[model samples]
Target: MNNPVITIKNVSKSFGKNQVLENISLEIHSGEIFGFLGPSGAGKTTLVKELVGLDTPTKGENFVLGGKMPSLGLMERVGYMSQADALYGELSAKENLEFFAALYGLKGPNRKKRMEMVMEMVQLSDDLNKLVSNYSGGMKRRLSLAAALLHEPELLILDEPTVGIDPVLRKSIWDGFYDLKKKGTTIIVTTHVMDEAEKCDRLGMVRNGKLIAVGSPEELKENTNSGTIEDAFLVYGGA
Candidate 1:
């Protein structure tokens, strides 16, 4: 196994009286695609938000790249895509990419190269000059993904990245993910989609703020005595 790239140590989060995560602890290895598999409101997104430094844990700690999270210095080393499309509606896709690239301190030829590369990865190169407001839901999602890849961060955190994507495009995006993994990038993706979960190197199954199981897809199926990931999830979910 590669060195630990992310470590969640007994993490917990609560909003008001509601606890979203409880005593969650896990380690994600470098250069692997780790999936957070669960249904909506299962605290998957909350856990990811803390991992990306967008939110703080109510208790315990999260470390990425060996440093404590919510650190500004680590922001540039991590790429994040939220469940929502956080794009500028009036700006052209290229402009949006440029704006975010500038934020990451990318400039000149290097910036241009990364912009082009990410656009191609998401298959949105042709729509570069189009205004984001005019783009479809799926297009916006792809563009958001491209933005996250702008800095070529070592860690990528995505929340339901393929929610609005068509099957063909979703496959293309997953292919891109594998390509990134080959290049030694670590990815953490949260999804309720069963097929996508099978593609992960390992999975942490979350349900009602608890991490019930952690293992490879095949291992999960074998341990559950199930034929598919979905059935395995059901076994873990007590259904």
Candidate 2:
């Protein structure tokens, strides 16, 4: 019954002769975790990039917050963490958070408060004073996640966020996601991991640049008469 926070209409993307996405249509409602489930090269990242306005769809439109994407005004309301880490290696984790917070117009005590809150969510509080270049791959990923959470955006988009994170930390991070969702934050997480996809409220199965199936984990498993999300993915001919 809630309004759709995101809408993709017949979206397609191509790079010259190579097509990366084909006629993908989807609508993500507010206050839920919607996931794009797929293997590498399945166009999951590309689709999200389009939604975040980093890239344009070759032949469709992606709307976020009821407005077409790439709109600068919407930036403050959306938080994005790409498949690649985008952090200043020379700066401390706290400094990186400070920079992003300032860009969102957060200042003084509010900015400092937000930085601490986000870092705590990612369990990187101890390393907040450490330079990013000194952090490990997993640590860097967590820092990127922390920065994205600093603005407390209404919509959160993460691409392969838990890739290098350990199991315990990943679980804690997902707990943080649940907390965000309860606060009515709409989240989109792209991942190839079946178990991770199972955590989503609904999932879009993608393969070879095509959207093969879309449903909640239970619905998908029931439809395919499968035991698990992985089995259901296979039944959908993903593998």
Candidate 3:
């Protein structure tokens, strides 16, 4: 069996009186591309946030890379690209990359090499000297992805990464994901797009704070007697 990179054991989260997640349990295998599929407000972000130790669960536990979560030591092994473009708009793209590289403890030749590689991967190498404030929405999204990949982390957590990207760029980005998978990186992506869900090795369907189903795209479609992921999702949501 493949080693589990991320494990959630009956985890739950609540904000004030609002419950965002409930008894969520999952295990993601190493080198696999896992998709957390759901419509907006389905707690996909909440679940992924817990995996990266950004937000602690109110109940149960989350283990990442064989250690209990919220561990700074473990964080060094994870790369996260949030939905928002968390970039320093005043800085140049290269400057932003340099800053993040330092935070990941990268230095000297390794930092420069990794920065160059990620910039190329995101097709932003030529824009290195451009100020982030002048970038388009799609460019900012790509820059965020480059920043997350700067450390060459073992696991990647991306939340709606392709939202503002064009189809051509999206294809290039997915190609990059396959290249990372070849290098033994575990990737988790959250999205509502059906076509994107089809590319995942396995998917966890979330609805109203509950994980309604978990399986490969084929398994889900077959079991639901549906032709598409959207149809399967409807069936699972009803159950």
Candidate 4:
């Protein structure tokens, strides 16, 4: 087994009296694709935000690369793509990438190289000169993904990455994810899409702020005596 890449210990979060997550505990190993499978409002985003240090857990902790989260130093080592697109609508796609690259301390040849590389990965090279404000919703999402991958961080965390993408583009994006895994990057993706969840090496089934099951796709299906990931999710969710 690979070393632990991320460790979530009894994590919980709340907004005033509205609880979002409840004692969620899980471990994601290095060089693996780990998925958090749950429906909307199932607290997937809340839990994910905590892992990326964008939010703090009201209870428990999130450890990444053997150190505690919300650490400024760790930010450079992680690539994060939030549920919302974080691109600058006023700037051209290339300009946005340039800004992010500069912030990551990338300069000169290396910055140009990475910018081209991620654009190729997302198949957005041609659209690089276009202003983001004029891009379609799906194009914006792809550009956001390109920016997240700008630095080739050791850990990649994505929230509903393919939500607005077409089937062909989504497949290609996932293929890029598999390529990254081959290069030994630890990836954590949160998705409500069952087909995407099945592609994960292992998945954590979260529902109603609780993790109901954790296992590989086949393991989950067999354990639940189900034929598919959706069936397994239903059995685990008690639906």
Which stretches in model 3 have alpha-carbon errors above 4 Å? none
Clashes of each: 0, 0, 0, 0
Question: Per-residue error at 66 for model 3, in Å?
Answer: 0.5
Clashing pairs in 4: none
For each candidate in turn, the TM-score is: 0.98, 0.97, 0.98, 0.98
- The lDDT, on a scale of 0 to 1, for candidate 3 is 0.95
Please report the TM-score between candidate 3 and the true structure: 0.98
lDDT of 4: 0.93
Candidate 4: worst-modelled 10 consecutive residues by lDDT: 1-10
Rank list by lDDT? 1, 3, 4, 2
Lowest summed lDDT window (length 10), candidate 3: 1-10
Q: Rate the local accuracy (lDDT) of all candidates.
A: 0.96, 0.92, 0.95, 0.93
Candidate 2, residues 1-239: lDDT per residue as tens digits? 37899999999999999999999999999999999999899999999998888899999899999899889998779999998899999999888888888888999998888888988888888988999999999999999998888888999999999999999999999999999999999999999999999999999999989999999999999999999998998989745
Q: Model 1, residue 68: what's the lDDT? A: 98
lDDT accuracy of residue 70 in candidate 3: 95
